[model samples]
Target: MPEITYRDAVIRGIAQEMARDNDVVFLGEDVAKAGGVFKATVGLYEQFGPLRVRDTPISEQAILGAAMGAAMTGLKPIAEIMFSDFFAVCFDYIANEFPKSRYMSNGQTKCPLVVRTGNGAGSRFGAQHSQSVENWCMMIPGLKVVAPSSPVDVIGLLAAAVRDPDPVIFLEHKSLYATKGEVPDGEIVDRLGTAKIVRPGRDATILALALMVPRAVEAAERLKAEHGIDCEVIDVRSLVPLDTQTILASVAKTHRLFTVEENPRLCGWGAEIVSIVADEAFYDLDGPPVRITTPHIPLPAADILEDMVLPTAERIVETVRRSLQS
Candidate 1:
């Protein structure tokens, strides 16, 4: 019933889980005393104390390496990567170690590790800081990838991620950190592998993720108000165990599909969503599937360059309008 920021919702989720379980611990650069770079973990250090909420060195490999070890042994560790782009620094450890532990150990070991990272562009954080690479984690076999668009989702998905018995890439989009939404009262943990229909319509279906979810809904409203093109907007919260059923069901009703994301056009998450729709619900679509995404280039720091490269509501409206006409 009360509106809260996405950042606060995340902190609540972590704190609730940590209070509920002693095995839960948090460690990352600036996560304790500094309270996280984005302030997502503020006030946690004092409440949980230094042992549970720790600040680690700025080494992704070392941080994740320690988290993997802790998770496998007895604890559920939440390791923050600061920026999603830094995951590359520890990809070898993730690829060769964390994800493979369960199978390699023949189910003798479980990796209940959750890596929280700030994701997406639109903050003008430049090429190095701005990237929507959740798709990379989705490609991995043993990892679960989930991105939250609203405050409710941040709390629900993060809570679920903390309790899951495997590695989870929990993405918090930088653009949506300040975004506010009404979160339900009490403990609510939305299951992984589920999608939500943010807006219902009849003309077309717009499938979006993370930061693009709000943009898609905005585009849908504009399309309806100005152009009379109603649209169904879907928030694909969980990427790894994608909710293909929800996507197909929406496509069946609207008869058109469009995928939106901040990631690059080539091989991005949007591409994967559209491909699945095309492959599974081929006959249900009235037009060819469309993908609205950023250009296949580094995100620029300049506002104008970023705007031109990024997907906008105007672009989404136009894309959906053109799809209907064709």
Candidate 2:
């Protein structure tokens, strides 16, 4: 086992899959020669060559349309949308085309393609590029949405997404690209619809996704050290096929729930989790489930304002402490 950065893990995951299957192809703007805007796909161009790992035109719609066509014709294409925000330009292909092909054709067609996008805040990319839009894709039916918090999960879940029989939106958090984690040697693949209990405790359950996962874990640590409020932290790695069983079990054990999310307050992924907990595990809860989220506003371009808007470890700790006390 060795420690690897999240950025490198993306390359390894794509390479591993492309090597295993000849049908696997990659195409995106600046992905071939420039090695992607974030350099996450570095060395892929040389490793996979120009034909398989190609650079596409600037049109997001064209990229996805081509990928969808390729997937329909029996090629497993991994198309990068550069920034997740660009999904707005190709919403038709995402919401209507790829996801619906299998259902409409009654199993006559399948779109086993993966849409890889750089997502989340912390690079000061401003409102347009920094929005955490995983919630957008999760709301749509017939799509699998995944956001990995660690290097190991990046490679493992990515492998799973590539092999899946349906469409998958693979969101790579911009902030976590530099973070390092230990990954096992040799083939790494993880199951979709699985939630990881990163930190276990008995007093409260803290659910977080993508960038919020680390913050929630840090908050749990501080809550224990400072206020004696032990909190369990769960990393919601996948959103569409959400692991409700894991979440409900944690809520039952802790008897309290809190969600730390980078998405805006309105219709954030945490809200859905809160609704589920209230609906199914209402009796198991000792207190109302609280959601700590970014205010409903466009993300700021300035570093200070951005930091203020996104949920932090301090905010998580304070929110959990206050909610538990009340």
Candidate 3:
């Protein structure tokens, strides 16, 4: 049980998948020679060779379209959109082409493609490079969106995404790339749509995704120390096929709910989580569900403005406190 950085774990998962299946190939800008913008695919090019690990052009559309074509013809293409914001450039191919091809063609074709991208706001990446757009993909019908918060989860979930039949949007928070955590030595595949309860408690349930999980956990620890609140933290690892049952059950026991996400408040993943809670666990909730998220503005370039926009641990704690009070 060796501890490794989240970036390393993801690289290991991709390397292992490539070794296991010759059909599994990685395509993205800088993926071949530079080992990816974040080095998540380091050493992959040398190990798998140029044919399997390719560096594509700057166009996100071309990258996605090539992935779709490769997937439809039998290869499992893992295409990387350097940043989550750039994913918008490939929306047509992702939402309509890859996700709908199988159904549109009467089940004659299957697009088992995994679109990997970096998300979240940090490191002064400015507004354009640091947007969390997973919610947009989650809105699509056939696309499966996943955001892993830890090294262990990232390794396991990426492997699962690669193996799945449907097109998967695998979002890794750029800020968490260097964060270290325990990851199993061998290949590990986390089941899709499963919500992991990181911390068990009876006072309230705090659901978080991606980097927000760590923030929620920190808030939970502070709540226990300051307000004597026992908060259960649920990592809704997979966003699209959300694990509503686990969330509802946690809310049932805790009687209070709150969600933390990096995206903006309106029409974001937090809204979707709140909607699910309202539908399935409305009566079970002792108070209104709260969402700690960014404001409905573009991610700012200034550090001070950026800090104010993104959800913080303090915000999560305050939201939990408010939920408890209500």
Q: What is the TM-score of each candidate against the true structure?
A: 0.98, 0.99, 0.98
| Span of 10 residues, lowest total lDDT, candidate 1 | 92-101
lDDT of each: 0.91, 0.94, 0.89
lDDT of 2 by residue, 205-230 (tens): 99999999999999899999999998
Number of the top candidate by lDDT?
2
**Candidates in order: C-alpha RMSD to true structure:** 1.0, 0.8, 1.1
For model 2 the local lDDT of residue 128 reads 98
Candidate 1 wrong stretches, greater than 4 Å: none
Give lDDT: candidate 2, residue 207.
95
- Rank by lDDT (best first): 2, 1, 3
TM-score, cand. 3 vs. native? 0.98
Q: Each candidate: how many clashes?
A: 0, 0, 0
Better of 1 and 2 by lDDT: 2
After superposing all C-alphas onto the true structure, candidate 1 shows an RMSD in angstroms of 1.0
Give the Cα error of residue 63 in candidate 2, in Å. 0.6
